[model samples]
Target: MNNNNNSICNKSVHKKNVQHPLLINFGENQDGDGFDEFILDTFRFVGGRRYHNVSSSKYFLPNDLPEMDRLEKQHYLFLHIWRNNFSAPVREKIITKRKSSLHMAFEYPSAIFIGVDISPIFPSEQKKPDNATFLQNMLDGLPFEDDTFDFVYQRSLASAISEDQWKNDVIYELHRVTKPDGWIELMEPEFLFSKETDAPNCHKFSRALLGFLATLGINGFISSQLENILTSTKLFKNIHCEERSTPIGQWGGRLGEMMCNDYIESAEACKPALSQFIGISHEKFDSMLENIRMEINQNRLYYKTRRFYAQKA
Candidate 1:
């Protein structure tokens, strides 16, 4: 969520003559612990209304998954999980830190977290001692030495790296820094989500999402197949994976209700930005979202989510 670093990074990479004020303001507002506090407060206010007794999800990093040959990427999973499990603030913190700590009660308190989309400006202040770090330097790649971390984690950087070599290099860097016997974890979701009883073409929003990502040469549609990527690396063992389907609009329960409501609100809030960047009309967007709500209300709209976990050899 730290925009300063990313803006600089983006500007440096693009080397363009333009400076975007919205992007600049977004960066400034997204810095430090205060931004996280805002996001957490928002989540508590809205998310509390949806589900009360849900336990924190288990933490997973990008390097963990089964089926090393599957063609799934990490960032898509991170965003889907964030949208499903987190509010804007909580997700901002999670992405900016590139890691998450859900089990402080576990033995290695400092070593446990989910690292994805971590920005250089925001250190891992969500946890005590702050043991993890992610470098955003496109030129420098990752900043860690070989075997520097017990786990390597990331997701949702598809737009940031357009070339296969850059992606491969980043993965190679991650593998080089990961300690032996450590673990790699990844979660990915297909750009589209659908309910079982949805009407024809109701998943248009998801489809458009896929189209946008495809334009960037990003496989935005990766979901439930992360294990293939892990297996291809041949650096991990003891792979474990699971998949869950959540209803989109129906009153499946508190979580569903919260997710639906948030999705609506966030979609509306981002309408202008979406239009500016993606050229989609609000009317069309709302119609699609409304369709999803109807499907959910009828208890037929559902979306698939996948998880992957693996340990190093």
Candidate 2:
């Protein structure tokens, strides 16, 4: 509350995240090009992380994702575990610090403001996600050297590939590229009834559909077994699994109803895939689905969704 305190900010929060408008907007000379790329190349790298060589060495902080995550975690780690953001000398000053978070507000405004960061941000006609370089290859052959990314995330490929492919190819590729002290996460669904209830049509239909998945060489039970599968590799440490009991009917409320509808829609796509395994006509399968829908509601079913995350040693 001092009279000498800053009043007019530069239409921004932190001085680090904000820049003169000329850098962030177009010059009006012609189509905006080269400026962004040129500015980005100036974000000098100290070791492997990013730093602003444009600034004097007084503010020595790397504005990389790990650093950003740490700053956010530092706030919570102090607040919840240690019980504050540690500006305890004057809590009012701490409040001021919070009110001035350029990154927490603007830095995360869109993943566009992010990079693998844009230096002083940028002026561009197109925004790229994480400045991500999109490349594609078979999961068996991820295009990277050993110990690459700081983190890896994979989801919902349970029905596309065989169990062997999952165990040998996909998981291995992820592990092989992740750095030590890094982390990887896997999310999948077991598609099992949470409890064995008297939903005959629901039970029958699930089995029939799983039989369909079998023909495609998918491990339909992948979600339930993900934790075990990850542990079997023994390549990671501090493995953790979180399970979600997603309700399957209106009785479970809004989220449950949506989950139920999603399952129905997913199942409906099975006819083309399922036709080879099950000899039922399209009309017959359609009728079966109607019964399954009614039975799930009557029986109060729940679906299993599981996520497993672990750190590398």
Candidate 3:
């Protein structure tokens, strides 16, 4: 996919991928947490359809499973298939933007694709195979030469690495692998659960779910702390931050509608597995999904996306 003559890959030969191994960590926790099911269902719902990249304001290839870990790879695979199955507009949106990205990068050409995650399934190797590598170690303790990579990217990592030590490990690893002028970008969303009486999208449920998730060692509240963490570590320079509150179930627009639908389907797909492994009663899980749907339909609860990128000095 890197065959563009853009700024992101100019000096480099026009290749579809680079050799510097995109180290992506997989989250294989199919336990009671229901995360695996959610991921799978997400792919099943919108695997191929083009979605917005809130960061670049552009669309890139959407895969059911990205060329990362097992879970992600599965999703990118779904994405590839979905794209082929989508209507003309969705397909056009994706193709046009990806081409634009290639063009834009030709001018900017600094190495841009790198990913790292703390895998839960086999810590030994990445779930799937790609040009990427899987680290069997903790994120806080990376074993790499100093300044090894151009950029460090992470998303939805909180559930695997709790909040307290999350930032410490993340900062440490990002700092360790990043080149002198590299960037570290992180993306995480909050998990909200409404009270039984209020339904979905109620601030109360959102707060309660957020609080519950926090206690479980997930940093569902990492949105506000990203900038502070970067600043405190002094590991990054020229930090830029952006936040977007996406309504659940695509309530805000086409994208939001997609998001909302994806969440519900993902929740349902994993419900059986979640109940089997996590012991969450089916009733409760269904209730939660229903609540989420209600909120989206009512234009009540939404999620905020916080993205920040900084250069290593």
- Best candidate (score: TM-score): 2
Model 1 regions more than 4 Å off:
1-140, 155-167, 195-197, 265-280
With a 3 Å backbone cut-off (N, CA, C), the pairs that clash in candidate 2 are 78-84
In lDDT terms, which candidate is top?
2
Candidate 3 Cα errors over 4 Å, as ranges: 1-131, 134-140, 192-208, 250-253, 265-280
CA RMSD of all predictions: 13.1, 17.4, 12.2
Worst 10 residues of 3 by lDDT: 12-21
Higher-lDDT candidate of 1 and 2: 2
How do the residues 260-304 of candidate 1 rate in per-residue lDDT, one tens digit apiece? 664555344434434445565767766766765665566556656
lDDT of 1 at 280: 56
Residue range 1-313, candidate 2, lDDT tens digits: 0011112122321112111111011111111234446546555665466555554222234444454444344333223322322221223321223321222223233211111121333223353323222221222254345665555555445765567766766676667656676666665677668654487777777787677667656678888777888899988888888766656788978655665665665566555445445787777887877887787777778777566778777
lDDT, residue 220, candidate 1 = 57
TM-score of candidate 2 relative to the true fold: 0.59
Comparing 2 and 3 on lDDT, the stronger one: 2
Off by over 4 Å in 2: 1-130, 137-140
Error of 3 at 170 (Å): 1.7
Descending-TM-score candidate ranking: 2, 1, 3
